[model samples]
Target: VCVFAVKVGFQGKEFAESFEVGLALAVGMTPQLLPAITSVVLAAGAKVMSRHQVIVKQLLAIENLGSMTVLCSDKTGTLTEGIIQLHDTLGIEGSPSERVQELAFYNAFFQTGFANPIDRAIRDSREFPTSDIEKLDEIPYDFIRKRLSVRIRRNGDSLLITKGALAHVLECCSTVETADGSLADLGPYREAIDSRFIELSNAGLRVLGLAIRNVDTPHLHKEDETGMTLVGFLVFADPPKADARETIEQLRDLGVGLKVITGDNRAVAESISKRVGIMSPVIVTGTDLRQLSDEALFQRAREADIFAEVEPNQKEQIILALKKGGQIVGYLGDGINDASALHAADVGISVSSAVDVAREAAQVVLLKQDLGILVQGVREGRKTLANTLKYVFFAIAANFGYMFSLAVASVFMPFEPLLAHQILLVNLLADFPAMSLATDSVDPEQIHRPRRWDVGYVVRFMMSFGFASSIFDFMTFGAIYYIFGGDKPELFQTGWFVESTLAGLMILMVIRTQRPFLLSKPGALFLFAVLSITLITIWIPYSPFSEKLGFVTPPPMLMVIALGVTFLYGVGMEIVKALFYRYLAHR
Candidate 1:
């Protein structure tokens, strides 16, 4: 409202000017809202002031987030829905019927102490016949016993229903009947049922044993919950994410190994890993990790793709071990349990809806909570790091030429290679575009490839290429000085003009990683524009302005030579760079 009022008051003013005034008044009148507005305004400031806060608290957080190399995460709510569902049932005994299944489902539905995935599955199974099914005494689920039992009244008769781990249920049952109405001794079937249970468990499926017993009279409660006939086992699981398998394959293509660090049972973790394209035949559990020394642990981590029953502390230990082996680890997590490990990784990335501490501790936050985002983030980070190194490479190279030309001219000639203004202009003009492009380059192929930092390689290339280019500029400047007249003041003017032109070309060469002859591109065009403007200023005539800066018009032949030498120098530098890059590639 205030902005509108101010804009209406200054209707005749230019749009931009009115906007500026209106903005000022609007902010000035609302002092209480200043802090919030100030945050928004300063949020877009340089990294050092905003995201890259220098305070110790923020610095430590950012460092931890950026340094994540391995991620340990919880399975429930992190990878799966934390909700289990029974999608199908296979009956092995006694004429499989929906009536029998509904009875088992009803018993499971009403007996619950916790809102676990298994319980939810029973409740979601569809409405049962409550009129015929009367509640009775119940034995709730126990982690150790791994079973539950209930007594109920149905159709004027009392019955007992029991469900539990298949192996435990089979141990107490003496006989089993098939759905085809055939009976078999429980002794021979025990091994077969146990083997099937192991198979299902290894695939991360939850298994449940079902059984029922009939009584002569209806009863609300009963004892002797044991010695019931075993019906069959039911398997349940939370389905895998649709893209998990494909994402794992993509990570493998980029040379990033996929490891499942989960607090689930070993069988469960192994199952999920196999389903998601992890081919590792072995799994390492927290118990196994606890028994190994640090060296053994690292060796194991290098080989294993699934770590199960991993506690929070063990997550950090695994990450540290991976880092010690010189691997750059990226930790992806979403729970508070992951915070410690997240803090210990090379790149800590969190899903958008992750716990507060996890998100705050992460360097990168994925707006979408998907594994694919982590893949994308890694690619972008690598490109950013590469471009930054390139900037450092070229900046040092250009500086080498500048330093060499100045040093050689001071010793062997009457004048320096460049004046103060010329040096300042070249530094500003050359650096801006180079830095901009360095920060902005996007390479599509980079995401599909893995890269490791090699400090030695960077230093070697920088020194060799930078020194060679500097020497060339030095020799070229010396030749110009000698040809014009070594000690004459007139030659000083020619030297300055020639050296400045050479410096511009040297900068142009540094900017182009490929061919330098192509100056029609936007980057090269901007470079030339700035160079021309600076050179024109040096020649501009004025009693106060030009004279004070030692301006002097040059001979027409000097201008031609300056332009010609610059073109030739650019061509030579490009050839040198190409050869150098080729040699490095082959090596």
Candidate 2:
């Protein structure tokens, strides 16, 4: 046996060389030591075996993941990748393409780092001004100013390029040109520009305004570049994920609500939401959220699907509010900013390539950073949980039938219904095969539209079936005992005959109803064979051991009575189950 096992171990060397070595060590050990060595080696191998352990761990993780009804994410890395790019530019008013490009170029060159997505986008554009320009001074980007400015000499004329937030740039501009080449007052044009900015932003585009002014040809300084002509606006943002639209639709089918929580402007977030099919009438901003109390925030969070300019702290607050309302929240993130909410979520999922801190906090890490895996993971989780529950249900019901029959026989008869070993054998034969096979059975419909298992449903079904089976088991044993006793009731002993017969009947009942009649083809031939074997075992008295176990050779009249009892018990159970199902349907 050891030599054969060692050969098989060599074939499995790719899986784990250590396992092969351990198996070989066991084969060479002393007889007593061999068993211990084999047991330890097998135990160690079980840990590394992918088949059952992977399924078990994945199922547990997925169950927790699917329970999440709310999700919180950081705006920068989570949504926009903290990178911005230009999509399309609409020159409202009479601003020329040349003017817009020149203003964008100044903003792009003046910004220091390529880290800011907007700056990189502007620098990448092909039409920006390059020739006949000499830089004089610059005012770097600032959080407070929310803008960048630079001074340059072009054709001996001092040009000031000031680019900043749309509202701030509009405020500094005294006048602007319309697209039709007419001069327009900044007041009315400001509203139109703001509206256009919103329109673009909601489509998932980031918008920045650019303005320039002609200053006196003095040695230009960074401070002198403010209060300039509104040159034009620049738009930049990361393109949406290729399958983001489809992924969002899939989530909707699974009854998961999708929301965009971003630090970008509200318009950009709204635009992305519309493109991705997350339509919600209400759009909320971080500034707006700050004004509301916690109670109001919670209510609004449920009602709103688009949030913009949202800070990291606000993400955590939103998750807490959703959870407080009895919703399970799952957070997906890959950034430090998302840490707080991720930690608080029921299940935190991070991509494998995510930051160490984020991965450490998450319960599940996707091998591939794809949203489709979430759907598949949830289905597998549901299947494993259902299979485990099915095993538990049958085990409990079978034990109840066995114990009920034994109790009745002990009270009314001279012999014990079944010995401990016989009872153990019946359970081993019936339960091991049936329950193990059930775990592998597939319900295709369940995979498509899986739902979270309700504990209440399992309890209700088990109790209904278990109670019916127990009653039937008791009646079958009682009828057999009474009938075989004949007119000389004290002389006749048939406890073993009734007990073994009841055990065979239980095996039949369990197998027949394993799958719903509507769902599975009835295996009547197999059931008949089981019943025939049971009959022969009790009546054929060829073996002395059978007689010792209290088997009785019953006459034809007693056989007829046993058959009738089985039929009546089965009919009664079907009627009860049908009525219970009807009540449940109505409720």
**Who wins the lDDT comparison?**
1
- Tell me the whole-model lDDT of each prediction, alpha carbons only: 0.58, 0.57
Question: 1-587 in candidate 2: lDDT tens per residue?
Answer: 33224434533323243334333333212122223332332332223222322221232455554454555544444433445566555476523466576667765775553245566666776555567777777677654456777777778877778777776566667777566656666777777787778777766667777777777755655556555666577777676656666876776665566566676677777666666566664788878989999899889988888777776778788778778877767777765566777778777767666677777777766654556565555445444434444344444444444455444443444443444344444444443333333234335443443345566755665567656766776666566556554343322334344443445454345433433434543334434544555655454433556556444455566655656655565566556557656664223
> For candidate 1, what's the RMSD?
13.4
Worst 10-residue lDDT window, candidate 1: 51-60
Q: Ten-residue segment with the worst summed lDDT in candidate 2?
A: 48-57
| Model 1 lDDT on a 0 to 1 scale | 0.58
TM-scores, all candidates, are 0.64, 0.61
Candidate 1 regions with alpha-carbon error over 4 angstroms: 1-194, 202-235, 280-282, 443-448, 451-453, 488-548, 583-587
Task: Let me know the TM-score candidate 2 reaches against the reference structure.
Answer: 0.61
How many collisions per candidate?
A: 16, 15
